[model samples]
Target: MSESTTDAATTASDDDAVAAASSSPGLSRRGLLGLALGGGVAGLAVGVGAGVAGGVALGRARAAEEAQTAYDFFGAHQAGITTPVQEHLHFASFDMMPRTDRDDLISLLQDWSYAASRITQGLEVSATGAVGGDAEEPPDDTGEAQGLPAAGLTITIGFGPSLFENEDGDRYGIADRRPQALERLPPFVGDDLDPAHSQGDLCIQACADDPQVAVHAIRNLSRIAFGRARLRWSQLGFGKTSRTTSAQATPRNLFGFKDGTANILADDAKALEQNVWVAVSDEPGWMAGGSYLVARKIAMLIETWDRVRLSEQDAIIGREKGSGAPLSGGDEFTEPKFSGTAIDANSHVRLAHPDQNDGIRILRRGFNYVDGNNELGRLAAGLFFLSYQRDPQQFIALQKRLSTDLMSEYIRHVGSGIWAVPPGAASGSYVGAGLFA
Candidate 1:
């Protein structure tokens, strides 16, 4: 037979072999489960003890056929702020090592930007990825997410007050460029912050639909920063407490109350530009399109809250738990009647409402977190509060108003951080490139 005919016959034979293998009763459910669980080739080999090669081939084929969701990494503003709130979050704060200089910091940001862009697109960290380099050298990626989908992952970077001017003084030579609005927050009325989790030089907010996908983004980025920066503190969150888009249903907190009823939606460009984005006149031109982020780890006194009467809970929250409506009896989206008799003067909704705060509004993208049971055998659960605003003062002012709310009795503010999130990086450029320029 001619070469062309021989090639056609080989292709037909391969197709038949695949069809036969797929129909074979010997292909066990355990093998398929291992593949579905992202066990990769090795797990498939172990799962199908006698059919190692075939199992590996099957796993690869399944991975190739899997669908993935991706978000654009390059944009006017970094994602995870205005992006629709994801189901899971892996937030990490990092402090630059004492020896890392300005140049080292810049290089690390560039490398992180490249890796973030690729990983968000469902690709490996580098062209020569896990198991691709020399036999002796460490792999580029950790490979825990080897065949996993991107699952709509977004990684957002931020620079804290310490990044620009730490106690050491002007470490990055950009102290003058730091925005005046990026200062450390003043002590609030009820803050019980732990020193270990209060501040950091830099922070990464990674969000995704899958927990592993979120964890993988932070893990790989932390790995890449090994010598330059070290993890200061991290928080894992699930069950998004707020929605950034109108399409998503408002999520509930551990208290079973609908949270973020009046949150700024992503589609509200006017509200976003006026309340979230930093304009050129805001100072430090590098942050023209940026926003300030406030993260508060609010620990809920779950046992105490659970024991409270339902009527008392409703009075404190100022909303009906069942409908998330104002106590005055309107729908969830109705304007809250702060003046109504049903609403208490110190109710949470009354204090948090923009109508009560000189029309000031901030975008909320918080989540409910359950770290574990504390030493007291009580569930250490609470809201991982995240808010983005044009200025840090927005959060400070709002939080000040909340200090007197009746809900304060049920919650204690523990971990806290403030960050300046610069505008998004354009294609072929790294995040915070303008700061370096």
Candidate 2:
């Protein structure tokens, strides 16, 4: 039951008594006058004050109760990918333990799937929750999110290229099922990749309107994965840099330019099918409804960018700083007029535009991150670029085209990974279940 209801029930009798006494008709006019003039007045004042306090408490409790929001865990497509982007993100990539075998990995996936489903519903990870397990043994859940709501939590999982064929060679014995487009991304120009943060065998993206809820989802999932998969790297992100739904307003990147203004919206089914989802004829059969994910941790050289002239910045981005409109003049969504305009020929938007790339497009769901000041006193901030496409080449082609863009000077790609997001699990199955079959 909601806390508001409990509070109302607890105070209902007292409120009724106050109303009854105040409304009683048996008292004489002098008695009523005396009641008003004597200590009865103060008593009534106290009663009214108590009622107001109760009402305020109940209102707050009701607001808190109503704050809890949830998303369906089971669907044709995973929740986090195409789900309207949430406010916070906790993304993690894991490497399977060497000692873990195929069966062990499969079992871990099953356990994780079940736990994720329960958690997204604002329930404990398991029925025998945080404290119900044996005292001597560690609890199944971490207990940090014990009283918290789901906050619209959604967990999406993906399989990295290395998961199929790594240095250890087909660790899980599913190398044969690896999609042709799931190979590691080719090095791009100006890439300063950190090997430690670049790749993983598996990845989970947890997102929610509440930071704690997003973190808790990853924490519990990581705990459940203890002996099976070790965390390789993780990135916490806030302030979504892109909008996947029409309901949301376009958000800005650390560069102060509106990002993803021309991004593919979730409602465009034709665009999604053409540019995002992997069709049966497009790749290995297991990836039919899935898509390829390319994650890049691009570190923005904030100190340098800040020093650039505003006009130069506008030219670099090919859009107005205030309105995000093309230099050729129009609203944010207006198509760029490449001919006879101040927009740089090598500007970011012009090169990244679909018209420039043979109508190729990708669904971008990026976020801005600030990791604190660097040792050199520069703000360590950047865009965590996450894009999904029908094929890996879509990203490769775009990156190649942008290699010479003026904006590249202000940003450096520090981490990158490419993963084949498997088709979503059926109600009774786990993610990547098709590969196992």
- Candidate 2: minimum summed lDDT over ten consecutive residues — where? 40-49
- Residue 118, candidate 2: how far off, in angstroms? 1.0
1-437 per-residue lDDT for model 2 (tens digits): 11110111111233332332222122223222222233211110000012225557777675454346565555566777777777788888999888778987787777666666677767766665678867775566667788887776778899998888877887889989888778888888999999998889999998877677788787777766766777888888888999988877999998898999988887788898899888888768888888888999999999889999999999999999999999999999899999876789899999999988999899998888888788898888899999999999999999999998989998999999988888776765677888899
Instruction: Tell me which residue pairs clash in candidate 1.
Output: none
TM-score of each: 0.85, 0.84
Quote the lDDT for 53 in model 2: 52
The global Cα lDDT (0 to 1) of model 1 is 0.78
lDDT scores in order:
0.78, 0.76
Clashes of 2: 0
